[model samples]
Target: MPDITLLIVDDHPVVRDGLRGMFTSAPGFEVLAEAADGREAVALATGLRPDVILMDLRMPGGNGVEAITEIIARGLPSKILVLTTYDTDSDTIPAIEAGATGYLLKDAPRDELFTAVRAAAEGRTVLSPAIASRLVDRVRAPQGSTLSAREREVLRLVAKGTGNREIAAELFISQATVKTHLTHIYEKLGVNDRAAAVAAAYDRGILG
Candidate 1:
């Protein structure tokens, strides 16, 4: 088989250099180019059309999520693999939602990273163990107990001590709508009230 082609995107030069060197020395992989941020990554991807894009989330120019979304929108052939330091739901969920083929942490072993890249190039979903567990937990709730994104948003605000009226205003929904969301949250979390709902969310790792 031909070597898998890659575009490495990261804001830090040292990281870029290290990734380029690692892939260059590895078998069955080719570093097509290096990009400093999302914008450059998009531009390079457009021109090179590499087999895989190794992306970092936080950057000065543009973000990995934006790049992934745009690449998918433009229907680029390159598969995106997120290699970031952040594993939080806020970071991992959006990247996956934006069309990343895989999510891996920066601390991953070199062999694991290589395997993830290869899997991404083949259009397979690849997630690090931590990210995989989080996604599973997010969807593995009992029947009728999974929280929707909107419900999670409401619960997050409630965890911060935001009142129903305040959450309504912040979310641009009616207080009645906020109440409906809260009711669902309470049911899903198996709680009786706001305080208990918040506590349950945290305990379930849904809040964090």
Candidate 2:
């Protein structure tokens, strides 16, 4: 295997030290640099151009998601591998969407960590088994909506530029009932007006 240089990014000093120690003592790996948080990680990554970055998701400074976004946006060459303790939807989804090459928990075994890093360096997508299982479950499970069928109908009518009274007549309901449905639609979609509600619905694929 060829030499793969790395930048270790974590807010904790001990974690950084431990990662550096392990990678440096191993063959075919070079610990090129380390950063305390996301902001420092971005700066070092831009300058050092390491083969891979072992990034932490949460930190006191700019979090890992933002750094990963910025790095990918700037077309940086180094692949990012998220090495955080968080595996929830809020954490993993954004980091993966932000262009992280891999996601691995800090509790991952030492060999698994090495394997993930190597895979990340080769531009492969890696996720811990638990993380992968959660993602699969989320995909396979049904997404229950907070909006009712009638509310969705109202929103669809709103998207089609139908007036309240017209919608009421078409649905054979009173104008007051149509207005009430609109109010419920606005609340469920978290918007204030019909136009915003329509836009939100379309954005969430409820209108499309």
Candidate 3:
């Protein structure tokens, strides 16, 4: 098989250099280019059309999630693989939802990273062990038990004594949506009202 070509995207020059060196030294992989941010990643991916993109989630000019969304939107063939230090729901979920083919942490072993990149190039879903476990736990959680990122946001607002109207305004969502989120929260927490939900959230350590 031909070597898998890659575009390494990260804001830090050191990280990019390290990734480029790692891939170039490995067999069956080629580093086509390096980008400093999401916008640059998008531009390079569009032009080079590499087999895979190693993306870092946080950057100044643009973010990895935004770049993944745009690349998918523009019908680019490059598969995105998130390589970041964040494994939290907020970071992992959005990157996956935004069309990343895989999610791996920066601390992943060199072999694991290589395997993930190869799998991504093949259009296979790849996730680091930590991310995979979190996803599985969410799926196995009882009905309405696992709060989505948005639901967590709504719950946090509720805990702060923010009314539905205020939450809607703050989150840039409709009041109806806020209400819907509350309903889900109630069901998940096995509470009938907002107050109980807030207490349950606190008990479950969903809110800090």
Candidate 4:
């Protein structure tokens, strides 16, 4: 297996060092870089191109959300895993919205953290078990609005990168109906574009 190189992004020196130690001690994982704040995180991540980035949610000079947005917008290949103390539903949704592939608490056990990092490196998502129900709730409740079952099916295909006609063929629905469902999905998710909708779906854990 290839080594999983990680970038640690946290404002606290102690936290960065501690995580670095944990990752280094774990077999097949390596600490590639450390950044004290979001800007530094972006710079180091851009330069070092680590396989995964452990990002703290709160920090100075750009913040984790903005950093994730910037990194993804710039087409960085690294996947971001948010390592934070905040576990509120509100916090969870936005961090995922910001392009985090995984979320874990600061107090997560070493075994869990290692597992999460490994899953993230392998292009799988990881969420803290503590907030798993909250994620399901967020998707189900969805700010007092919901997608129809059919619309959701269409969105799932869209999330998988299928075009309207492809979705139509796959679901045995008309292309026009597929477009209609996409429109409803866009309205419900408050996204103006396909990529935005896909991002929202993944953020809400509606799509893996």
The residue-by-residue lDDT of candidate 4 on 104-182, one tens digit each, is 9999999888889989988898999887876786577774146677877887787777888889899898999888777
Compared with the true structure, model 1 gives a TM-score of 0.71
Top-scoring candidate (lDDT)? 3
Q: Stretches of candidate 2 above 4 Å error?
A: 144-208
Cα RMSD of predicted structure 4:
13.5
lDDT of each: 0.90, 0.88, 0.91, 0.85
Q: Which one wins on TM-score?
A: 3
Task: Give the per-residue lDDT digits (tens) of candidate 1, residues 1-208.
Answer: 9999999999999999999999999999999999999999999999999999999999999999999999999999999999999986668888999999999999999999988998998999999998999789877755224688999899889999999899999999999999988877875666789999888877778877
What ranking emerges by lDDT with the best candidate at the front? 3, 1, 2, 4
Clashing residue pairs found in predicted model 4: none
Number of backbone collisions per candidate, in order?
0, 0, 0, 0
Report the lDDT tens digits of candidate 2 across residue range 1-208.
6799999999999999999999999888999999998899999999999999999988988999999999998899999999998886668888998999999999999999999989999999999999999778666743324567888887778888999889998889999999988876765565788888887877877877
> Which tens-of-lDDT digit does each residue in 1-208 have in candidate 3?
9999999999999999999999999999999999999999999999999999999999999998999999999999999999999887668888999999999999999998998998999999999988999889876885446789999999988888999999999999999999988877876666799888888887778887
- Candidate 2 lDDT (Cα, whole model)? 0.88
Better of 1 and 4 by TM-score: 1
Which is better, 3 or 4, measured by lDDT? 3
Better of 1 and 4 by lDDT: 1
Provide TM-scores for the models. 0.71, 0.70, 0.72, 0.67
